[model samples]
Target: PDECPLAACVNILAPCRSVYRWQGKVENTTEIPLLIKTTRACYAALAARLLQLHPYEVPEIIAVPLVAGLPAYLTWVATEVLSSP
Candidate 1:
């Protein structure tokens, strides 16, 4: 996806299946999730870009907060993304 602020990201097949009702039937499917290491300053624009270009009417985009991590790893993540808001 364009406009992503991360210098690198991890994409993997999600472990759990997504279940929902569609047209009076239950639909279950697997999804590939992308874990992007980006700065908080870039999240809004990044999310907007994904929504604009996404094929689905509704895409599942979730941002998990990083409460704690190795200082070096966190620093690496911060450096990979833009510093300016």
Candidate 2:
């Protein structure tokens, strides 16, 4: 078994900044991001689980569909989460 705590944990160079009204005033901030890769079978469970753990009032949970990918890598992603430790 792998030493990873999750099936797949990826770190990408994502630099972001968002502007929002907090207390009747606009505020902006920059932050790093964590990109999680999970399968369709596990998406619902993962989203629900994250909602419970996340502290954001309206957390951002976005899924970007893959237009194309290597067959073997895609297969690995589909089954990785279900792998037994």
Best by TM-score: 1
Every candidate's CA RMSD: 2.8, 3.8
Give model 2's TM-score versus the native structure.
0.70
* Candidate 2 wrongly placed segments (more than 4 Å): 1-7, 12-15, 83-85
Error of 1 at 44 (Å): 0.6
- Which prediction has the highest lDDT against the true structure? 1
- Per-residue CA lDDT of model 2 for 8-59, tens digit only, reads 5566557888787877998798755668877666667777766786787767
Query: lDDT values of the candidates?
Result: 0.71, 0.69
| Residues 1-85, model 1: lDDT tens digits | 2364543355665677779887799989876666766667777766777788778788887788888889998888777776665
Candidate 1 regions with alpha-carbon error over 4 angstroms = 1-4, 14-16
The ten-residue window of minimal lDDT in model 1 covers 1-10
Q: Each prediction's TM-score against the native?
A: 0.72, 0.70
